[model samples]
Target: MQKEIQIAQLITALQKGDVTAFDQLYFEYAPLLYNRIFKLIKSPEIVEEILQEVFLKVWNMRAQLEVDRGLKTLLCRIADNLAIDHFRKASRDRALQEELWTSSVGFYLHTEESIFDKEKQRILNEAIQLLSPKRKEILTLCNIENKSYKEVASMLGISANTVSNLLVSAMKDIKNYIHSKYEGA
Candidate 1:
């Protein structure tokens, strides 16, 4: 009963912005609060940090202090809430980091495949370039542009049979060129 009266006086003094009373409150309650917080969070560093934050919150909100209830209860509640918040934030950060790592790995695989495809295209283009101009034009129109033999023959002023023969020869030459180059490598 006597201790309660002293604490009530401290609370009233604190509401009026008495620094000495606030110091007394800290000296009296901080250790108990620290132990309570440490039980929830096993790190000494985190416990110390949370203890300071709890006291800071109390000091900031001293004007609303309710002397009728236990001040220790209020302090413990604040410390517990802050510790839970810290754990929630840490969980969210860990999940976000894992998501980023997965995305980067997927991007790396896509990039590697894209590079390989570009190299193969370069090699095929080189082999096509080695053809005679007329053969290259015929093959490009028929295969690359998806034109029919008749369409290519009409565009190039040749017979459809001539276009077909030229395409067959062009395909054979391209296949031989690719096989020779890659086989040697």
Candidate 2:
């Protein structure tokens, strides 16, 4: 009960732009947040980054702090959200890498002996150019730039679902183009 009162006081002070109070709150809560984040992320480096981000968010949202709801709850919620974002990005990156690898392998295995590496690259580039501008940009962000659906959506100001659908469509079109170009080869 006493500790809760202290935390509440700190939160109240933080909301009033007290940097010292914020530092005190951080010192008291950072270890707990780090452990909670590490459970989800399992990487010290990334956990550290997310820990910093959580505090940064706390600072940014200081004015809106709800002291009655418990600071620990808010901190944990922010940490969890950041950790989930990391996982989502990592999962998307792995899937994209696998798709590119599979495409490259299939291209090599199915192409004729006369098709040199440069020619294969040229064919792939030609296929990419055939995409509509939006699809092309989506493909570049997802594959070439290695960005997550969320990142691409944020960049283009579109929904993540839209980014995902366009990427799937773009991949299919690229595959079809490559297949047709090498059908007899």
Candidate 3:
């Protein structure tokens, strides 16, 4: 009961933009949060980065925070969401890298037997240019620049899911364009 009152008082102070209260809260919860995040991320550097982002978000959105809910629960939810976001991004990046590598390797091997590398590159460029501007941007960031969906989404002021969907569509279109143009020739 006493601890609850302390937590309530901390929340009230935090909502009022009290840095000391924020620090106190961080000190009280960061370790537990770090452990939870580390279990999901499995990298100390990434865990630290996520923890910082989570607290920064909390501080930035303090005015909208609801003290009625348990602070620990709120923090844990934020941490979990961030960790899941990281996992999704890592997974997407790995898959994209593998696909790009595989395609590049096949193209390289095929080019060794023929002098069609330049033509193939041109065709790929043309196929990319056929996409919508936003889709082009997604492909550039995600495939060319090797950025994560979240990074691309943040850069484009869209949701990560939007970035993902656009990338899938763009990749499919590019593949179809290339196949139709080059398959029978």
Candidate 4:
């Protein structure tokens, strides 16, 4: 209750252009926002970029801040939208997609509770490995590599329909493998 009161006070001060109040709010909420973004983006660099953008937006739109809507809600919606935009951009840019995937593993180490995450990653890796080579390649290209159906079809010299079919089959295989592994647990 007291924290809520303090947050409301800070928001009111921030509306009046108080830099100290803004700093206090940022300090209190940045970690929570950062963690939320990292979970969605899985890339430290992009997460940091989005975190800064979230605050910049808050500051730029300070006049519109509504304490009733809650600052955390506003920050989260901004971060989620930015993360979705990043994915959309990445889908069109092969280089960015590759960079994000390559750097993802490093970011997991930054979190203390990554042991369970690592195990899940291992299981997913195993499931992918169990797929046929061609199916595995298609899944990696279309999903992990963030390639469009047309681009992947062109690269593989296969029809878009074939690519789609293989992708669906591969996904089912992965799903079944994961389900079987965890069914009894």
Candidate 5:
């Protein structure tokens, strides 16, 4: 059951410059929001910025609020959407570097198709294990499942550019891992 006097109400009070309410709201929700942002973005600095922005947004929009449910879901959605936006923007910034190295990028053709599904699965597992969960999620959502960038972004609650960035990073890591493991074997 949901509490009648919810944290959103506390947030509304905080938005009105109620210091005690703000402190109460922070104590209640900040840690959960922080971890949610951190797991996705993986940067304390960026997470701090996102956390501040989230509170600011809540405060700025508090006047128009209506809550028929628990504050947890609403707050989680806001933090998640915002963190995805931040990471997506950062990912786009990193893409210029990839474009510069485009000429240096090479594609390899596999001549040996003799490996059975079991062996292929083993190598694939190793590759997946080498990735951080975020990267693995990016690949699973976009590549293996054949979702469009926008689709993956929506599913992950981020921007298309962020999806692109995560996909790029994940691919690079997987390629390097596979090479080091199978190059001379």
Candidate 6:
């Protein structure tokens, strides 16, 4: 259902810093993002900030953007991530925060929380960074924050259905990204 050619054109335009292209995509997608996001945060103040951050991140990374999968999905993934980060930073000092983190992240702890493990940490960070924002957020929430999908969706104002859909897509992308890099003998 995605307009593939239009999206590819938009991605190309966005990469060139085309204002019209940016405005076109932003106007079209920001509402869906805001609605999906505000359902959880419910704060116009933080929601606006995170929304801006999501678009900005998209523009910043536009050079690397690919639309074979549709730009809307990528934007959705970005929105999902910023929402999680907003929640993480917001609850950084809450009493039950660790419990929340553990539930959201996987058992991905290395020797320490520090990326000082150099090679290993770099590879790990690359993998994390390559994840569609949704997967990274899901991994963050379930493993790092220890949150359940129910809780994560509640915080983001999204249905568990949406969260599950995005998480599944993210996991598949991560697997493919990692597999392509590691598969060669």
Ten residues in sequence with the least summed lDDT for candidate 2: 109-118
Question: How much is 32 displaced in model 3, in angstroms?
Answer: 0.7
Model 4 vs. true fold: TM: 0.50
Per-residue alpha-carbon lDDT of model 4 for 1-185, expressed as tens digits?
99999999999999999999999989999999999999988889989999999999999999899887778988999989999999988887987778788778667655645787787788999999999999999998999899999999999999999999999999999999989888956
Candidates 3 and 5, the one with greater TM-score: 3
Q: On lDDT, who's better, 1 or 6?
A: 1
Residue range with the least summed lDDT across 10 consecutive positions in model 3? 111-120
Q: Tens digits of per-residue lDDT for model 2 on 1-185?
A: 99988988898999999999989988999999999998887889999999999999999999999878878888999999999999999999999999999999887777854467779899999999999999999999899999999999999999999999999999999999999989968
When 2 and 5 are scored with lDDT, the better candidate is 2
Measured by TM-score, the strongest candidate is: 1
User: How many clashing residue pairs appear in each of the predictions shown?
Assistant: 0, 0, 0, 0, 0, 24
Candidate 4: 10-residue stretch with minimal lDDT: 105-114
| Candidate 2 C-alpha error for residue 154, in Å | 72
For each candidate, the alpha-carbon lDDT, in order, equals: 0.93, 0.93, 0.93, 0.91, 0.78, 0.80
Q: Flag regions of model 2 displaced more than 4 Å.
A: 110-185
What is the per-residue lDDT of model 5 for residues 96-127, given as tens digits with 9 covering 90 to 100?
77865663453211223334555677887898
Q: Note each model's CA RMSD in angstroms.
A: 2.3, 23.5, 24.8, 23.5, 27.9, 33.3
TM agreement with the true structure for every prediction: 0.85, 0.58, 0.60, 0.50, 0.47, 0.48
Rank ordering of all candidates by lDDT, starting from the highest: 1, 2, 3, 4, 6, 5
TM-score for candidate 2: 0.58
Indicate whether candidate 1 or candidate 4 has the larger lDDT: 1
Candidates, ranked, TM-score: 1, 3, 2, 4, 6, 5
Which pairs clash in model 5?
none
